[model samples]
Target: MANHKSALKRNRQAAVRNARNSHIRSTMRTFVKQVRTAVATGDQAAANEALGRAVPYIDKAATKGIIHKATASRKISRLAKLVNGMA
Candidate 1:
């Protein structure tokens, strides 16, 4: 419980931000999972397509501070490698 008015406002803001951040993070994970699933299924075309969709989601997540820039780069690199290896 926040005693001060500003603290109460901040708590409310934090709750909203947490929900928004969670959505972004969940979307990012779904994109990444799609790419991985495509790769695992040995569908190069599908994997490439999913990877394409995932890159931007990943970059956006990084840009929005949901994930670290390096982590995003690493994920992109790994996904690319998987897709490339399928060819």
Candidate 2:
């Protein structure tokens, strides 16, 4: 219940941000999952491809402040290692 006009606007802004952040987070997770799925199936080419795609999206999430940069980097590193190990 936002009483003031300013409060109402703030609420609206928060709603939009929430939606956007959630979408970004979900997409990023999906990409990560794709990588993991490929890795689990022991598909070297597919794992490499998924890792390549996931890295940029993960970095984008960090850039948008949805995730910490270190966390993003760690995720990318782990995914890369999984793909590499498939070789």
lDDT tens per residue, model 2, 1-87: 989999999999999999999999999999999999998998888988898899999999999999999999999988888889888
Inter-residue clash pairs, candidate 1:
none
Which residue segments of model 2 deviate by more than 4 Å? none
Model 2 lDDT-worst window of ten: 78-87
Which candidate leads the pack in TM-score? 2
How does each model score on TM-score?
0.96, 0.97
The runs of at least 3 residues in candidate 1 whose Cα sits more than 4 Å from the true structure, single-residue gaps closed, are none
